[model samples]
Target: MTVAKTINRKLVKTITQRSLSTIAPQVRIYEVGPRDGLQNESKFVPTDIKIELINKIAAAGIKDIESASFVSPKWVKQMSDGVDVMKNLPRAPGVNYPVLVPNLKGYDTARQCNVEEVAIFPAGSEGFSQKNLNCSVEEGLKRFKLVADQAVKDGLRVRGYVSCVVGCPYDGPIHPKGIAKITEQLFEMGCYEVSLGDTIGVGTAGSVQRLMREVLTVAKPEQLALHFHDTYGQALSNLLAGLEYGIKTVDSSISGLGGCPYARGASGNLATEDLVYFLYGLGVNTHIDLVKLMEAGRYISNYLGKPTESKVNRALGDRFKNHNDIAKMASCDV
Candidate 1:
């Protein structure tokens, strides 16, 4: 059956108005630096630094920040202190902190902390599903469904993630059909929004356009978000393709701090600095202070003992060295 026949009627509005050449005047950048960016680190980032990193990012005015992930500490060592991170986090007004909940147990733990939102990640390819969650795609979705159900009943928002939307490191090529099916299921399971991820950073503009065609069939642009990895240097190009589909919410990390475990360090998501710089140039309103954002980026990068992977961050590196030199950084970046 076509998507119109299979998906919810409320979501099946006019398809003719689905594409756009220019981005929306207002865009929402979902900040994932504190959780996804720090998940695979060889050393555990102190809870102090994690809270500080998240607070600093919030201070820069990002609305939706993915602050922590409630996964097995055995698998993701850096996120072991998820509880402490949540407890110690200074509640910021107008800022929503969403955490990743991979299972029902994780979701239960997170709910006790009074989290307003939770995200569930399911893979597009079978190979990745097995490696990442040790289950088939179908089984993983079933697991996330339980979490989504409870989250809704608890009066919390549920966000879904479909990883490896273009291609997977282990699974190779992914057909748009699979992504559409998964996206539909997430929506059916009560996900308010689903962010499609190119986990290994292998997606190109052509691939994104093709994949989004199928995705938009099952999902409204407003109900979807884009998350691209920059490993192949095609993140901006791929983002443009998603923008054409009228997807205004995008996932990004501070200073490009996260990377796929398969790849080297800190190369996964699009750098928030680069994304903001692009949007600002386009006259898109993100309501984020570019100068303060770089300061936050520099904070985490400095503590991580690695240089920032953001091109925008590097171009203005000199200014960040002197935190109070906001004037210098602004002159250099904007």
Candidate 2:
């Protein structure tokens, strides 16, 4: 159970670097396209297409994929067949496919699918709780505790999610104290890692820095991940801040095709293509193929009939065209 001290030391060192040098050399991207991205879709995506997207994400060399969530159909109709989606998806080698489970009922359904890893979400804001889960923050955590305990006994790896850590539509300016307390509860409940989410996409770098400063006091930076929405177009900026603080794990979507239903007009999670481009440009190692990843993003965006939210995808599209044109001219030279 011991991680080599050398590895841990190097990781900690990478996290301490300044924003200009903050790329973690080796970043872990948790792809949430199938679950977090699709959960907000008004149109129901076919199960077959969902499986295909998981395969495409895996093919793009993303090591962690949030495959689906086990929630009620009434709430998230697109993810109603989470168990079936898991059973049918192409299981790529060396990829961790984690599903989101809200409570013991969701966990029970996920376990029936033989899921080895699952994530539970507890809101950090009370107003968001009343609107989203129809319960108090404490009640949500109590339910999460039951699910977390049972999942551990069932030999499942649990990752926790804390939503609205920065701003809430119903309540503004959440304190770091509340975020830290909730995160501590998640970790205490046996979560292997806790992903702090800016569900409404209202966080700036300054806010994210403060939030991380508090959360890290209780949770190790290595055990934390950032899940940001780009509503204010500050996701990359905040991500930069996370890197500076030694947080190497991030959750993002391809083509940026999601938003929280509870918080309208939010730009959803940061785009995977954009995050990959940002890291790769800095010579940081993410191991994702930007060109292929863009293709994946483009494929999904095309299917959705929407222009991509990724700056990198649009730029790459232009570059791809130029590359093809140059190849044609070179053939003429021959």
Candidate 3:
């Protein structure tokens, strides 16, 4: 009788856990550290390290990784070796390595590398569109539409990014309607998915909820992804608000790398370690190997000669370090 009762309790616990996880389903983490995270480095990261860093992120179980950008060296000196990085990457099976292309020229250059997918970045704020692309938003979208059309004909998937969803440095406090309009156009432009970026990270949960309600009106939750920077410490909260509305995809960087070059006060993206830890706690399935992910974060942070910006990585790093120290001590003569 006692054994039967214990088995019955265990079965009930497993069923309850499964039910809890069904609230949001699986969360797909698109790792953007190699491209967005490292783009701002004043020092050029050697192509070798970039390749290894990307592979490490992939080994950590990230299905999608932004490998490089095909912009000119005059603009982003760090990504000057974009072609070599793409050509030499040991393109793993079952993983998507998408590169960012600024215009038809960049997209055509990326085509030579036989990339599987290409991502187009067009900011929602007119100020950013002029500053970043040196044109109005309408003109910029027209250019990207040509690129998207060509990419489709070439048999490559196109991903869209709408930056400055919540606020902008030059424009400031962008209305949700503008964001939705851009999202709607991108969806109609042959982009299988679009990632909305809170580039300056000034968004609150209330702001995120408001944006969610507006953006969802034009695009379904599954067709969109959230990219939030941690400048104001609200990235996690803003994500939670979006999650409440059933969005399951997020873009995060390892060790919290990346800052807006165009926006002065903005910061790095929300740390991958932080996001995965948060989701795991809520019983949401991320399918990421946290230990491997942390190792990858530590590798890049060490290479960059800086402490990591991830709070979760800092916490677990010490624990793992102490554990390793104890293991070493025990191996020595008692």
TM-scores of all models?
0.89, 0.89, 0.89
lDDT of 3 by residue, 198-274 (tens): 99999999999899999999998899999999999999999988887788899999999999999997889999988
lDDT of 2 by residue, 112-210 (tens): 887789998889999999888889999999999999999889889999999999999899879989999999999999999999999999999999999
Q: Residue-pair clashes per candidate, as listed?
A: 0, 1, 0
> Best to worst by lDDT, what's the order?
3, 1, 2
Q: After superposition, how far is residue 322 of candidate 2 from its true place, in Å?
A: 13
For candidate 1, list the clashing residue pairs, or say none.
none
RMSD (CA, angstroms), candidate 3: 6.8
Per-residue lDDT for 1-334 in model 1, tens only? 6876766553444432344334677889999999988887687799999999998898888999999999998889899899999988999989999999999999988987889999999999998899889999999999999999988998899999999898987878899999999999999999999999999888899999999899889888999999998988999989988887788899999989788875433265899989987776555678887777888888988887888888888887645544334433443643
C-alpha positional error of residue 139 in candidate 3 after TM-score superposition, expressed in Å: 1.0
Residue 260 C-alpha lDDT in model 3: 92
